[model samples]
Target: MSSMKTYAHVQAKTTRWKLDSKAIDQGIAYGLMIAALFVTYLVH
Candidate 1:
């Protein structure tokens, strides 16, 4: 029973961690897009 509880806790932790990394990935993508736009604007 205790092992099952531990497994549940770890599962939740990993799920949350995955969500956090996904958010970070989205942020980086947005940053790159903005940077590309800025560069284009400067070139124009």
Candidate 2:
């Protein structure tokens, strides 16, 4: 029973961690896209 509880906790933690990383990755991608657009605007 205790092992099952521990396993559940670990699973929850890993899921949350994965979600956080995905959000960070998406934010970085959006930032890079915006930067590229700004650079292109300035060039033209």
Candidate 3:
């Protein structure tokens, strides 16, 4: 019973980390796109 609880806790923590990582990746992608657009505008 205790082992099952521990397993559940670890799973939840890993899931949360995966979600956070995905969010960070998405934010970085958006930031890069904006930066690219700004640079293009400046160049032209």
What tens digits encode model 2's per-residue C-alpha lDDT throughout 1-44? 99999999999999999999999999999999999999999999
For each candidate, what TM-score against the reference? 0.93, 0.94, 0.91
Q: Which candidate tops TM-score?
A: 2
Off by over 4 Å in 3: none
Compared with the true structure, all predictions reach lDDT values of 1.00, 1.00, 1.00
Q: How do the candidates rank by TM-score, highest first?
A: 2, 1, 3
Lowest summed lDDT across 10 adjacent residues in model 2 is found at: 1-10
Q: What tens digits encode model 3's per-residue C-alpha lDDT throughout 1-44?
A: 99999999999999999999999999999999999999999999
Candidate 3 CA-lDDT value: 1.00
Least lDDT summed over 10 consecutive residues: which range in candidate 1? 1-10
For model 3, give the 10-residue run with minimal summed lDDT.
1-10
Cα-based RMSD of the predictions, in order? Answer: 0.6, 0.5, 0.6
Spell out the clash pairs found in candidate 3.
none
- Compared with the true structure, the alpha-carbon lDDT of candidate 1 equals 1.00
| Superposed model 2: Cα runs more than 4 Å off | none
Task: Give the clash count for each candidate.
Answer: 0, 0, 0
